[model samples]
Target: MHTIFEPMKPIPFSPPRIDEKTIEAVTEVLRSGWITTGPKTRELEKKIQQYIGGGPVLCLNAWTNAVELMLRWMEVGPGDEVIIPAYTYAATANIIIHIGAKPVMIDCEPNGFLMDLNKAEAAINENTKVIMPVDFSGLPVDYAAVMEMAKRHAGIYKPRGENQSKLNRIMVISDAAHSFGALYDNTPVGREVDVAAFSFHAVKNFTTAEGGALVFNLPAPFDNEAIWKDINRKALHGQTKDALSKTQAGQWQYDIVEAGYKCNMTDLQAALGWVEMDRYAQDHLPRRKSIVARYNQAFQSCSWAILPKMQDDIVESSYHLYALRIQGFNEDDRNALITHLAEMGISTNVHFQPLPRLSFYKNMGFQESDFPRAFEQFSNEISLPIYFDLTDEQVDCITSAIKDYMQSR
Candidate 1:
């Protein structure tokens, strides 16, 4: 008897959608010789602002840094508490800690990924300064409900800083890393909250190689444009003028206002984002939605499968991730299923492990058992590949692998 080896499928979990257009745009930026936070970056920011149709948009290096800047600007510090769901990625909670603020982790809604607004409301106190709700897997967390909750707690909100005083209420910053094109109440997500941060990381629906943006919709008298300018400075060592402006004749003189962090988006990175933005609404998003629809159809009849909510009357996801849940699956069962799928040459991932389960948050005295709903979600959740480049055949292969594994079990 002769032993033979089988070739594995070449399917990736999530890859950036790169094409000639992207290459050409990047090449153009490279040839321009003014790559760091120049015209290309500004162009991308303007394009994002126009597409969102919300407020001023400020594009920065990564989602984590961009949002951390916003938190710093809001003056959130040690004694302040920011409400967030424990079901999100570590970046969500890490940023809170980075800013010296306490992250008041709460449970997810009974059967959903979004944070429970009731739990969030109950967690509020005089120290509560912000409510950073994540749009997990691109599904919008009831923005209206979160906004109303913030408003209801206005009486107890303590404004420690000028920016916080301006709002006079707890700010609602949407961790919209996965929801660049999602809609809430038929409107784009950015406008729903006071500020929404979008990630253009390689794996996100919209990729910039590495980038993120903050769309400000702060209420009247706040001057979002002024805030955008201020954040631009804050993102660049608090410099009076960006490198692009400083390059001009007789514009060399500048001053630093605050000791800020360096996380400005480079022109080369923005070029990729600009090209993707061009085809996002027409090509990228539709294809992702189609893939999700196919997945939903493939698993809908299975008794063990629980399909993710992509769209409802109030919200529409960007179809960033197909977060499927296996009914009655425990942590061990889910891990085994993942291994089985891997053996079949299919790539799958858990959207998150829940912050409390991780070593850092756990040591912070955050227990997984305390947030039972979050733990329940994490134990059985599987994030399947859903990207613009993924073909229908690949989707079928993935679905077949999952069904085969579940049926065998």
Candidate 2:
């Protein structure tokens, strides 16, 4: 007979896959004298570039900081608008607010977590400087569609700074925090957009304790390497050389080119990322894929289940979140399921509550009713746990709990 699972030892929602390997790498970094933003950070950037085969990658302190710096580099400020989806984390809009730019929020498609491209196109005007599409739950947005939209709107595009003048159109910056290893058009997600910002927070599939990165792939007439250098300098207080380079003989003398933000990644964080990147493609991602598959198998036959969009011909998700929706289930039903699971030693979460529902955005005159689809998607959505360390048995247990709850109801 099988023993009953107990709530005393509850399953975590999304824990970092910290093993002996991660411990060893971090220990080595601690032992080294030079610990902050050193060789390991640079090495991790290179590894990320190689893995994605995109433009130069720059690792920074957080996704919010990296993308905010990108906006500052583009000189987006008052009277400029950056279009974004309504269904996403607060950080997506917070970064825009930090730059004094308006975040023109658009509603998601009906029964979808991603923004409606048709509505997005209609929402564009001359003040629109950037279009930051989020890859919700590791599933990449239609980046090519966004690029085409930008090109179509080039005639009405307004240029603020040198960087904006060079592009001569709305910039497409992807909020790919959950899609580090995902693919769009059979290539990595970072390649299609002008810039892709990824999060390496503790709960992500690829973790570095607390960090993020940017992959630059701007079109011609814009030198990516120079932009990378400029961003590197900007991330380090606009200093001519980083701490690692300043250590070299006769390199002590450096000048501050601009008053830049301090958001560079440290060696300790980079070391953890390095260890993750070393086995990411070969080991970590495959395991996530397996868990997603198991969840899919369990829910496919259920009439009430609306499975997440994991993969298709054009795109493949990184499987960051298994946001499963239930048909005919209201918000109360979803919360009930979560509470029931918690009582049975399982943990589940909701991906988001939609930005308009939040007090800050709502106070900004953004009514939740305006984005009906976003509210519809958020009301019934449930994000199940999917991580590298989640075992097959645990997957079954979690699925069984959900099935039991639904069937009983």
Candidate 3:
């Protein structure tokens, strides 16, 4: 019974690849005695901005904060309606609820992870202030199409204040939690949209354990630096000075500009992020792509395989989540497949169950039946493991398992 596959070799869904360099970086931060938001945190922000090719980047505690902060900064409150896709995690719409704004959800495109832009256009009105599109499975949405849609509805845009007045259209803040290094037309994900918020959550391709950032790329008339300062201050209890500034002689006294929430990233987290960021495009991404290629090759001939798009000439993913779908399969079929995979020492996940289907949103009057496209995408979806450290053998085992189950039926 000789076999290449290790029967008991456990493969996690998305295990982080924190190497010696990352550990050393974090250890140095710990040894430096400046643990909380400090030099390392600021340095990571700058590095992210440079990598994004010109944007005022500000690090936050979570992607949720990045989304909420964008809404708060835009003064999108009561009576404002932010258009969103029904096919995303709750975090995307929860921010709108947090700000007392309405999240007008549009159904996803048929068999697609992204929102239906036509539905988005139809959803727009005088109350529409922003459009939050999720970068599902690390794939970039059509920013150009969304932007063009927003422009067409310019005449109906209602401005609440100076920030809203500057832009005579709906603001697009992409919830790019899964798309750190994804590309659209050779431009990075952050640059394509008005502003993009990326997550570095523990399971994400890029990890700081838990952190997020917003790329400030507001074109003309809008002071990008001022926007960064504003968001930075808001993320840190509205204090006039950050800890780095307070460390200076006679600068101990500071003013509270306004009541703000605390959502700043720590130096320890930033140290890990610095290491991950440096290796992302170079080492991590290439390996992840290879793993994906292995899965694609293995599943290429399967009749039921609806493989997740890796990339084409115009778009490339960060290879965050390998969300595979089983054609003509329902929720029961997908869950059974997950159970079968689990029995064989492989871990799998579902990309998302559309927000409308959740209990909370259901209680809030959202029905799963309303977003038919999203539900269709969800029912048969299963996210496979794809990380920098995932091996070709493991990919083969995982894909073989999937194909076996698929073909048996």
Candidate RMSDs in Å, in order, are 2.7, 1.6, 1.6
Would you list the C-alpha lDDT of every candidate in the order shown?
0.90, 0.91, 0.88
Where does model 3 exceed 4 Å of error?
Answer: 1-6
Model 1: per-residue Cα lDDT over 180-230, one tens digit each:
999888866788889999998889999888889999999987999999998
Q: What is the lDDT of residue 142 in candidate 3?
A: 82
In candidate 3, position 144 carries an lDDT of 86
Choose 2 or 3, whichever is better by lDDT: 2
lDDT of 2 by residue, 122-218 (tens): 9999999999989999999999899999999999998987989999999999999999999888776788999999999998889888999999999
Q: What is the lDDT of residue 29 in candidate 3?
A: 95
Point out the worst 10-residue segment of candidate 1 by lDDT.
1-10
Best by lDDT: 2
Clashes of each: 0, 0, 0
- TM-score to true structure, per model: 0.97, 0.97, 0.97
Clashes of 3: 0
Off by over 4 Å in 1: 1-8
- The residue pairs that clash in candidate 1, if any, are none
